[model samples]
Target: GYIVTHVDRATKYLMAQKIESKTAEAFNKATLSMFMPLAPSKRLTLTLDNGKEFSLFNKIENRLKIDIYFADPYCSWQRGTNENTNGLIRRYFPKKTDFSTITDNELQKVVHKINSRPRKSLDYQTPKEAFSLENMSGALGT
Candidate 1:
């Protein structure tokens, strides 16, 4: 399985889904499903990897009513929030963890745990708290 991870820049909120494949179609479906419930806001934007699997990004932008940008090659730091959140995820499932063997419920538990913690970036508010308080803005200085 492949892991698709998303982190809210404003709140450090995390959402992840495991897919059977890493194709563009799989990525698109997982992305839409994870975000559909919140529908978050039009202010949402994504900083993503330069991967062919994200070829359907334009479709996601249209459905979610948001913008998307690709990080520069070899510059993982460009997506700092995402990188940090990935580290947090690593705390639970270290490098080379067999994602295919991990169940979705087990993964959601990690996501829930990460979002419930307080962060200094959000002034000590939990990511879940800050996410609800966002009012559809201010993730990337909006």
Candidate 2:
């Protein structure tokens, strides 16, 4: 099993869901389920790591009307926001933990805690707060 993580660049708002695999189809489905309800303008772009799981990036771009850019090979810093998100998740589940056994409710609890935690980057505002501000001000994009 695998888990897919998505972070809103401007807001630092994050979402993760456990999946049975990292196939393109699965990734697309998960992305849609997680983002479809949000205003399309809020999702202006996706900076993805170089991974086979994102082979279907076009589908996501087309479906969500968002640009998709890939990070340079071996350059994790390009996706620093996502790396930081992964660190937060690691604190809860750690490495080597079996995600297949984790329930949806359990995953949501962790997601909630992370979104509620304050961050210095946003002047100590929680991701949820930053996201709300972005939406309110129509500042989700560059």
Candidate 3:
């Protein structure tokens, strides 16, 4: 299985799901499933790595109506927040872990831990608190 991650840039809120494949179709379905609960206004821009799984960016943009951008090749710094969160995820899942072995509930538990943990950047506020719809709108100046 492939673990797909979508993070809120402002609050560090993370929405991660486990998918069976890393194909463009899987990424599209995972992304839509992860973001569709929020209003279209809340689902704004998405910055993704230049991975083949994201090759279907046009379809994603059309479905989500969100602007999409890609980081320059070899420039992980452009997506610092996502990279840092991936480090945190590694604490649980690790680099060599077989993602297929983990159940959905186990993945959700990890996500809950991440969201509940306080971040130094947010003045120690948990992402869950900072990610409130109202708070996110204000933080995003929406």
Q: What tens-digit string does per-residue lDDT give for candidate 1 at 11-103?
A: 677889999998999999999987777645434678789998999999998987778899999999999889988899999999999899999
* Model 2 lDDT per residue over 100-133, tens place: 9889889889999999999998999999999998
Full candidate order by lDDT, most accurate first: 3, 2, 1
Q: In candidate 1, which residue pairs clash?
A: none
What is the C-alpha local distance difference test score of each model?
A: 0.84, 0.86, 0.87
lDDT of 3 by residue, 1-142 (tens): 9899988888899999999999999999998998778777777789999999999999988988888999999999999888988899999998999999999999999999999999998889998898895444553311
Give candidates' CA RMSD values in order.
2.2, 1.4, 1.9
What's model 1's lDDT at 7? 84
Find the candidate with the highest lDDT and give its number.
Answer: 3
Clashing pairs in 2: none
Cα lDDT of candidate 1 equals 0.84
Off by over 4 Å in 1: 40-43, 136-142
